[model samples]
Target: MKSFIFRQFEIRQSAEVFRVGTDGVLLGALADIRNARKVLEVGTGTGVISLMLAQRNPNAAFLGLEINQEAVQLTRLNFVNSPFHSRLKNIHQDFKSFSTQEKFDAIVTNPPYFEVSGSGKDKIARQTIELNFRELISKSSEFISEQGVFSVIIPAEAGNEFIKTAEEYHLFLIRKINIKGIENSKVKRLVLEFSLTGKALDESEFIIEKSPRQYSDQYLELTKAFHVFKG
Candidate 1:
């Protein structure tokens, strides 16, 4: 199991269960919460992204929806043990069946990534829950407020699909950052945000490692506010 230990919370992730990864951190850190007053997080696996946003945006009220009972219970436990526990609400509900009954200033997700048929150690964690790429874009668009931002981290292939899907739903790309392990490695992930305009999308790329073992200064800096590691 790989775990994330914070001053107030900890996420214990397993290959069997949906584990947290660098993509979640990248999405959380780069997500634009500057003007967002209220936020919604879909498929709150282990509640990692919600906690990250809670730390970064102190004033924002974060609502998270999760389907896994075990994960929901674990998230609740982690929250109750945290200093900012009171600021979070972890709902045990399927995002597909959930209706917030109100719009949100923002919505973020590190959704399931596996296909109906694929070989993987973490199949559940890597695939979509019930919402496919198109359904996610369409359903999420209905919940977003005017000019609200929607952020997510998906596989590199899904990134382009999401852009095309968002285009159909009228959600425009705002910013995107591609992530790689090393200079010569293939781009594996994309951290992105969308708004209501198709005009002027900010595109960027990031490398997590600069060499064989050292972390890139950019990677360290972006996560410095949360990770205890500083160099």
Candidate 2:
């Protein structure tokens, strides 16, 4: 079975779509769930981030929106079998056309960022073929509540540009975590938080590994609650 068992939940992976990995886990674990009563996760490949956040924030209800049918089916099954089934819902829809009367207190996504040169399934997974960063910012600005927070994890190369675009919509950065694979490695991923208040940014670094096979203390500490191996 292509299933991964976590301390409080399990994810069944589908070969035809994007699968869970360290990036999603890190984003879910590190995002601020404070004051969040309703959450929305965009591009929820298998709903892993939503699951993690739901587990961490027991009072929050979650809605996961995915563009792929395969992923929607898989996420639905995973949510159904998890303890937070009553608090989670999965929908198959493109974010660009997604309409809802509800406003979310927390919004998170691990969006596609690479600039690729093809029109294949892999391109959909790696590149922004359907939804771009600018559109994400604009739509998020419209739907996020006054005190809500928006969070996302993306490649370092595109992250700065994303921050700039978000500023265009008056969504200011509140917190940022630079992610490096190791101590001396160049920054590769950025986990960022934005809000309407335009508060001063709280910045930090997170190294994923101490060496080739061992996880760093920061990574282990951040993910210990969900990762069985961390215990």
Candidate 3:
């Protein structure tokens, strides 16, 4: 399970504490990366979203920040072997203590879900990149350029809480896509975009699987370019 393959890129894990998952895929697909010039990703586990962003926007250069040493090594490797490898630059640092004299046109992230308790695998590794809701929003707001978008994938129950938190920073809500495990399943995650502007915009939901062993066409389309399992 340490090595995972996507249609566009192959990920090296094991040294990777967090392997690629549905949340990262949903954020990569649902993000609006069309006109982005610069982008940033916090807690960039395996650099999955960074790789996805690079695939989506070949012209956009990305800065992916991660704190895990093993993930840092693997993300760097992933970027090296990826299609848009040159488009990315990764840093081994924490989002809180790390700052720049630069601003990004777009930002995307998949933070840790606090819905479950930790197993104490790597104390510093887990807590730092745990993807806390508040820190992510506040930091993105500080780094994003005006009219730019901030995108993230998070647990559905915790997603709304992020909106409320961002409102405090004047980072308005833009669009959202909710992710479900299956057609009739409960909402599992939210893929959202935020900006300095807010308008009543279109939002939708996606069901990943039509059946246990069968992934839906829509899901395949969104992730087809990324998953090798899909032909």
Candidate 4:
């Protein structure tokens, strides 16, 4: 059993489920969930993002929905083993067909972004074979409260099209973080937040590395509470 050790919790991982990665870490650390009382996480893999959010927001309750059976089970195990287990729950359900009368104050996801192509083992987790951008945006808009925010991280190149699709659902862009792999490099990923009411966009850039294999101060500071770096 592969595991990731954090300052406040540990995440057990499996090969069948999407293991811990940079994207999930970024979303978990950057998502705006401080004011959220109830949070919903789509496609929860190994339950790491929700776990991180739970640690960050003590007042929030989190419900994680995962379509993949193995992933759901993995998330459940990881959640149960964590200190924030009481506030976290995982369900085996497809987000596309999920319906809830209750609204979420924050809906977050590190969704599949790549277009369906080769038949890799991690196809469902990495490719848009199951959930596309339009479907994700439409469904999230339905469950988000009037003041809630829907947050996701996707490739920077797909940002414009994603924003256009979200606008169709009346979810206006509110916050955006341009993520770069290294200093003086082009933006590689975009962490976007949208809401029902439009507001002045809060845009910023984040660099992960100051040099090869060296973490940037911004990255280190943002994740100081979570990551347990080695000396």
Best by TM-score: 4
lDDT ranking of the models: 4, 2, 3, 1
Ranking by TM-score: 4, 2, 3, 1
Q: If scored against the real structure, what TM-score would every candidate get?
A: 0.91, 0.96, 0.91, 0.98
Residue ranges of candidate 1 with Cα displaced over 4 Å? 1-3, 13-16, 116-122
Give the better candidate number (2 or 4) by TM-score: 4
Candidate 4 per-residue C-alpha lDDT over 1-231 given as tens digits, one digit per residue, 9 for 90 to 100: 758999998988888888899999999999999799999999999999999999999999999999999999888988998899999999999999998899999999999988956768788999998999999999999999999999999999999999999999999999999999999999999999999999999999999999999999999999999999887
Look at candidate 3 and give me any clashing residue pairs: 6-226, 6-228, 7-226, 7-227, 112-130, 112-131
Off by over 4 Å in 2: 117-121
Model 4: pairs clashing at backbone N, Cα or C within 3 Å: none
Cα error of candidate 4 at position 186, Å: 0.9
> Candidate 4 at 133: error in angstroms?
0.4
**TM accuracy, model 4:** 0.98
Residue 200 of model 1, lDDT score: 86
lDDT of 2 at 136: 85
**Per-residue lDDT of candidate 1, residues 112-215 (tens digit):** 77777557655545666566777778888899988789998888887878888898898999898888988889998888789875668788989999998888
Clashing pairs in 2: none
For each predicted model, how many residue pairs clash, with residues at least 3 apart or on different chains? 5, 0, 6, 0
Give all candidates' CA lDDT scores.
0.80, 0.90, 0.80, 0.95
Worst 10 residues of 3 by lDDT: 122-131
Model 3 per-residue lDDT tens digits across residues 1-231 = 557777788888764377777788778877898989998888787888888778878899998898887788889999999878878888888887878888888988777665445576544434534446787788888988888998877778877778899999989888888788988989988888889888786698888999997998889878777777724
